[model samples]
Target: MLDYHIHTTLCGHASGSMEEYIEFALTQPLREIGFSDHLPMIKWAHPEYAMPFEKLLEYVQRVLALRQTYPQLPIKLGIEADYYSPAEEAATRSLLAQHPFDYVYGSVHFVEDWAIDDPHNLDQWERVGVDTVYELYFAQLQKAARSGLFDIVTHTDLPKKFGHRPTKDFSALIETTIRSYKDAGMVVEINTSGLRKPVKEMYPAIEILKLLKKYEIPLVFGSDAHAPDQVGRDFAQARQMAQACGFTEIAVFEQRKIVDTYPL
Candidate 1:
């Protein structure tokens, strides 16, 4: 199996040490396991995601060092970077340039200057309507794809995590975003974490999956695991979902290269 979006304890909210995650990955016969922990913020403003900026290099070194002991399996050192626009792009690029990541999974955890979980501002999104939320979401996606730094885009339809089910227009914009990523030769991950969340739907739900198939965008599987047991979880069901969407091969990355493709 290919699991390219595993997180470790370096990020405060996640559980399990790197060794524990690697051990679990090995037991599951994962051909490639990517350490895609959240990226440190450019200004240390976001507390909900990432470890301290000072610890980033050390974490990268540790993940790289682990590859020597587990040479039998490919362990990729990567980062799931938060996508910001030109305003903070300089700092973001500087941060990314510091590490030789195997792959960069660009993500947008915040929408319209606020992270979804912000205690005081969430209810305002409901008033904005799911359609407008979707417009902003896909616009950010296009920005992310054109950023020229990310290798893959994680959880393409993450805005739904706030409890707004998407409609036809939303799905269309998402299809356009996915097609842009595919044209740019960037991989799109199908994260299974949504199933465990209140949203109860995978990123880019089944309808979007069909659009991805039409675009011929390569697929990748990620549990978005933050704990030991979460590693490789739901991959079986993820495979079933991929099969139902007509995907026969799921892409895998290692040492910054597209090394293998696993069959569903």
Candidate 2:
């Protein structure tokens, strides 16, 4: 098994060091583990949530050094980047180009100024209709995929973090989101973190996974672990869900490319 979305303490909200995560992966039956800490935001600075911009180099060098120290374990350095809007595309591209990341996971944690996925903003969900929120989120996700700035889309259905569901069926929206990913030639991560969230289910829900399979979009597994013990957590269940969705292979990346794959 491979976990391509592991985070370290460098991402302020997470605990444990990169080495600690590697040590934990060694205890699991994992073939590869990628360190994908939160990328420093160019427009925002939340030290409590992510590393400062100045620490980017240190974070990369630390992961590179670990690769040498743990030659037996396949460790890939990756980043979880937030996609805000087209206005910031150039800056986002420039920042990402400066680093030689194995993969960049694009995500949308906000819709305009609202932090829809933030726990502190859960009350805001009650102020707006669930369908409206879903529309904004999927729109942002589509834009992120078309931005051509990511190898994988992390936590595809993250807006449901607080378990809010649209009164109307999201079949069309789900299909459109999957189509956007397919059009971009990008992979989607079945992030296991949702299992620990209020939603209590893997991200890119089963229905969405079925649509992804129907479109033949490649899938990848990510624990989205913020701690050592969380590495590879619930991966078996994630894999089982993928298999049920008719996926037999999961993607692996190197130098920002899908270099290989492993069977589910």
Clashes of each: 0, 0
The digit string of per-residue lDDT tens for model 1 on 34-124 reads 8899898774466557878778988999998999988987888889998867677777877888888888899887767766544456676
- Writing each residue's lDDT as its tens digit, candidate 2 over 11-59 gives 7888887888999999988999898888888677778667888899999
Off by over 4 Å in 1: 117-121, 166-168
Locate the minimum summed-lDDT window of 10 residues in model 1: 113-122
TM-score for each model: 0.92, 0.97
Checking candidate 1 for backbone clashes, the offending pairs are: none
Tell me the RMSD of model 1 versus the true structure. 2.0
Task: List the global CA lDDT of all models.
Answer: 0.80, 0.89
